[model samples]
Target: MNSALEILTKYWKHDAFRKPQEAIIASVLEGKDTFALMPTGGGKSICFQVPGMMKEGICLVISPLIALMRDQVQNLQNKGIKAIALTGGIHSDEIIDLLDNCQFGNYKFLYLSPERLQNDWILERIKNLPVNLIAIDEAHCVSQWGHDFRPAYLKIVQLKEYFPKVPFLALTASATPRVKEDIMVQLKLDNPQIFTKSFYRDNIAYMVFETEDKLHLLQQILQKNPQPSIIYVTNRKSCNETVHQLESLGFTATFYHGGLSSKDKEKHMQLWMNEKVQVMVATNAFGMGIDKANVKTIIHLHLPQNLENYYQESGRAGRNGDKAFAVLLNNPSDILHAEAQFISVLPDKKFLNLVFTKLCNYFQIAYGEGIDEQFSFNLNHFCTKYSFPTLKTYNALQFLDRQGIITLSQEFSEKITLQFIIPSKEVIRYMSLNPNDEEILLTMLRTYPGIYDMQTAFNLQLIAKKSNHTENEVLSLLQKLKEKNIIEMMAKSNDATITLNEIREDERTINRVSKYLEAQNKLKTEQLQAVLQYSKDTKSCKNKVLMQYFGESLAADCGICSYCISKNRKKQNPETVSDKIVELLKIQDFNSRDIQKLTKLPKDDVIFALQKLLEDETISINSNNLYSLK
Candidate 1:
């Protein structure tokens, strides 16, 4: 067998392992359960991939993110390594064939979701494979204390029953002490070797700015940096608006959100990655599995819900170890907004029960009989029918999804099914009567073979393309046809698909997951409060604050963070500070806050300098409370 370094050199082209990766890989190769807690961009994947490559049999890896799994599988395959991800949307027969390939096709790696372990047949098939290693990525999800906990992860421990002797390697980029402990216990890691790299990023300067005009601050920062960067927003609307704002200011920018099609996401990502665009204004969906080494900054236009998410997102910068910045722009209103977006939407037991009961009723799922059933769920329609608030109902459904009660696929699309109720000759005659609608009706007729015999689903875009009309035009013509009783049409706007993961017991179903829901909601509240405290903090070293949150401590302050820089500024001569304030006042009337922002000094120092200038009769406050030259 090749050494881990040899495998790394051959496949990854890395000369050596990073930090404790070598040690962790050695432990895994020695048939010992291992836990590696490395920070983001800390080379965590190598810890398992190298050891798995060195071993003889297929390495079974479990992850919660489908995108991450697909990305990793693609990366491995690009390296000429045999790997496959059994994510969702795969047919059972295909999964069986893939498992058989893993058994007999000499495949080196098999990636799958933790939820896949719930299938007994797959488990039985996996039991017979010569699995040399079991790797769990994002292992923190196994713990209830984790920020992104998934109940499906709790089922991952069942693999131990099948592969009792297989070494399980668990890896996560961020985990608290509590979460770390829970991961080990939940994974049943026996006497596991634990390796934790410090969360400190020496090259990153964490900064938080309080500003009412966030757009101005954003422009200033981007202008100063003028390098590849990511500006994170809270929603899709913000993504587009920020991009437009940047474009109007002569900045080359693009945006990415979950709502974007795969093609558009790839196009935007490529534009940013190739440096064709200077900035990527995106939601949190854009960064997973992306390994850009020279992102100069990660800026948050709004407050993050938790420090864990903030840390992971900000850590994207400076991967090549050059100086970079992680900036958070905040205002007084951001706190209230964060609370509303994160805390207020949390579904309690009552809300969960209501959503659960209503969902089953909405789908007409009889009591105790909805397992594995799928339905096209139109969230807006459902909400309007029940007079439920949209966001709250969506959150409730998400909670149900996280609990593995129902699998919600939020891939929005318009579903239209239609059939010609009249005879073919009558339909042709009616189409000829309406000359304007002739092309679209004929296009639908040609596109769907069984439209006249039965209600057939069709792509509106394809119909529009074939008929030389826009989707809206085609939809309008279809509505006209329905009005004229030429056809039976059923149209619904669906943003998600609901797959029942468990039998319908109504409230009983929700009652089973109530404890977890309550605990997670409380945790979310605490996490949000911590984030608010972090934003409001001005005296603490920003880097130290983040490190401490992740259960690490530093003996010295990071000299580059905003707090440290401000502290250093405070030590400047008072007269020099006053001179700078006077020069700013020389330009125009300015308030103390504006002076502090312009001078990049501490609040007290700015106030002291302003007082000194006033005392010296060099500047005076006008009726508007702005200081000017006297």
Candidate 2:
């Protein structure tokens, strides 16, 4: 076997490991379990991947994030490494074939979703693979106490029975002490060597600006910051609105959300990634697996509900160890609105049951009739039909899915893509052989080329229109074609994939997870309060606050933070009234006395504000020495 360093240098072209990576890899190579708590951009993948490359058998990676898996797999493949991800919506036969390839096909890595572990057939097949080390990414999900918990992770511990000798490596960027303990116990990791890199990001200047005019402040920040920044918003409307606001100001900006089609998402992401656009105003969905290193600024327009999310997103910045800012713009309304949207309407038992019943009614599934059945759920249609708040109802569905009541995937089918497994002549022959499915098949073939060799992205609506069929008809035909092997279709995922986990029961049974729901609600509230406190905090060093939240410590204040800089500025100036006035004057033309009336500052402060504005040349003193825009 090649040494780990040799494999790393050979594939990654790196002569050195990033901080704790070497030690974590050493533990895995020594056949000892490990909990690697590296930061978001801390080269977590290299820790497990290098060891896997050096090992004899394939590394089995259990990831909860589909996007992460896809990105890693693509990156590996780009590096001439053999890796495959068995994500959702895959046909069983394809999964078996992929697993078989991993076993005997010399595949280096296998990335799969945690949900896939529930399949008995898959487990049986996994037993046959020469799996060396099992690496669980996002291991925090196993901890119900963690922010992004997934119950499917509880089933991962059973792997020990099949691969008793294989070492386990659990990796996460954000996990509290409680979450860490839960992960070790739940995964049954055997005396794992725990490696935690210090959470102190000395290079990141943590900033919290309490401002009522967030948009104006945002514009100012954009003007000051360098290119290729990210603006995270709370909702789709805000994302689009921010993009529009930036565009109106002549900035190259775009928006991304889960609602966008796969092509559109990829296009927008690529545009931003390639720096074709200077900024990407996106929801929480846009930043995983991004390693652009030079993200100079990340402004959270709304307060993140928890520090974990804030830390992870902030960690995205300053990855290059250069000066970067993780800024949160908040006002009284921002926090209050965040609380109401995130915590208040978290769907109690009545609300959950109401949504659940409406869901059943909408699907026309009678009680006890739709067990294990699947349906394409459109949240907008359901909410419009029942006149429910989109966000609250969606959160209710998520909670239900978490409780194993139903499975809701909002963008599942949107990522589903397909390719023709056969040649064009064979496709035409098969089209001739089957008269009923020709239109859709021909439409697909005519619509996209290179489908024979690679996965081609597809749109059911477009295909349906070209074939003169409804979306359902197009989907059924595609699946039927896939079954016949004329074309291979990725399992459809765009609609909410709702699997009635159990036969539809009455309100009493559906609300059985009420206590669990209440606990979740409580946890969510606590999480919100934690972030709120962080936002409201003025006495603590921002870096210290973040470090303590993650159970770490910093030797001293990161001097680059807003608070530390403000303190130093205060010591130097002792009076900031002039600075505040300059800010408003820069926004528009304002005479000094009018600025005083608008700002209601003392005469001395107003004179100071005017003098500062003139000195800074932000506003010119006219013939009368009154301040005006330069």
Candidate 3:
């Protein structure tokens, strides 16, 4: 095996490793558990990928997103390195075949979702493979204190016993001290070598604005900034509304959400990535594993549920290390809205049991009979039938999912699968009629073995390239083959999947995880309050506050955040503040808060400057308490 440096240059085409990359890679290679806290674009992947190449056996990469797994696999294959992603929706037979290949075929990397680790069959198959390293991406999910806690991540602990000698590498972009310790405990990492990069991005300037008319302010922001921006909303409906308004203002804007079809999501994403669109309006569902470097701005119309999410999302800006802006637009009512829509909607013990009973009845699952069973879920139809409020009911389902009672997977896309139904003789006969189809089918066979055995996720784009045919031509040939009964083709379909872990439980079985759920709700409320404080506070530098939140005591102000800029301007130039206030008041009588917005000054300075003007008799207050220059 080549050294890490050799492999880095040979494969990734990089001459150097970023800050702690070399040390982290070295630690993993020395057969030690490692935990790396890197920022979003901190090249965490290289810390593992380079080491994986220097090892003798396959590296098991655990990830959270199916799209991310597919992307990494495709990129490796494009670079002539064989890789595979064990995504959902694949039939069991195909899974077995793929695992069999992993065991017998000399493959280097296997990208898997944390949820997939809970399967006994999957665990069994993974035990048989010559696994050299275990890399858990998004490792913060293992911590109950983290914002995105996935109960499935707990199953990763079971791997240590199976691969006792293999080193584990856990990576996350952000985690507080409590969450950090929780991740270490939950993963059972043995004295792991920890590498933590600072959460500071000097290139990004954090700015927050409180306004009544967010749309008008958003327009002004879009008009002043560069292209290729992302506007994140809190809901799918807002995604459409924002995009429509932006487009109405004569901008090339598009919207994306989980509600959109797979094709539309891909279309809109590509349009933004290719610079065909100037802006993308989306829910939080967007911007995971996205590698756009030139995004000049990211404007959040609402506060994220937590600072971890806020930091991760804002880090998307200025990835190229260029000057960029992260702007938050907030309204006074957003706090009340967050409380009602998020914390208050959490289902209590009573609601949890009811939702469980209703869910079992909704699925018609017999008591103690539906264990390990899967079903396609239509929540809207179920809610309508049972007269359940969608918001509260959905929150209950999420609580159940987090408690490990069952697994609920939504927010997925369509995948194409092809299988051979008839004998090879029929396929040959059809190929005889069409020689070009013969070449394409042969190319698929050469590319992916056992396509005749079961349905598999065939790459249409890759197949077109290999067969020297356009994608339309490839689809046409597949349709031709399906029409002639040469192969069975499954068109892309997108929906949610729910798998019952045990029989639907009443109070007894449900109570086992009840305390955990209650703790989760309380933690969520705390997280919400934390973000609200960050958004509302104007006295401190936003970066310093963020760094302190993560337990770093770095006292230096970023010096350029909106808060610091306002603070410096106000303290240094009190005269300018008074002048701006007087100038604005001369136009029309206004309150102190409104004057702050007009002057873009700090609240304290606005108040102080207003007092100075009144004492100097330069401005007078009316009976309504609106101020004006006299």
Best by TM-score: 1
What's the lDDT of the predicted structure labeled candidate 1? 0.87
What Cα-based lDDT does every candidate model obtain?
Answer: 0.87, 0.83, 0.84
Q: How close is candidate 1 to the true structure, as a TM-score?
A: 0.83
Native-to-model Cα distance after best TM-score fit, residue 447 in candidate 1, in Å = 16
Task: Give lDDT: candidate 1, residue 350.
Answer: 93
RMSD of each: 6.2, 8.0, 5.8
Task: Tell me how far the alpha carbon of residue 67 in candidate 2 is from the true structure, in angstroms, after superposition.
Answer: 2.0
Q: Arrange candidates, best lDDT first.
A: 1, 3, 2
Estimate candidate 3's alpha-carbon lDDT, on a 0 to 1 scale.
0.84
User: Which sequence of candidate numbers ranks them by TM-score, best first?
Assistant: 1, 3, 2
TM-score to native of every candidate shown: 0.83, 0.80, 0.82
**What tens-digit string does per-residue lDDT give for candidate 1 at 430-539?**
86778888888888877787898998876776688678898779888888878989889987767667878778898788778898988898999999988998888989
Better of 1 and 2 by TM-score: 1
Looking at candidate 3, the ten consecutive residues that score lowest on lDDT are 407-416
Q: Candidate 1 clash total?
A: 0
Per-residue lDDT over 1-630 for candidate 2, one digit per residue giving the tens place of the 0 to 100 score: 888788888999999888899999999999999999987889999998999998888999998777788889989999999999987655566677788898889999999977777778788888888999999999998888988777778899999999999999999999999999999999999999999998887788999987656787787788888567999888888998889888998889999887776668889989988999989998888888888978899999998878988888888887777889999998888767997889877888889888988888988999778765667667877889999998899898988776656766556355458887777898888778888888787788787877788987776766887789988798787778778887777754444557775677868765566767777788899999899888888888899888888888778888888777766652324146766666776787666557766776654456655666667776677677567667
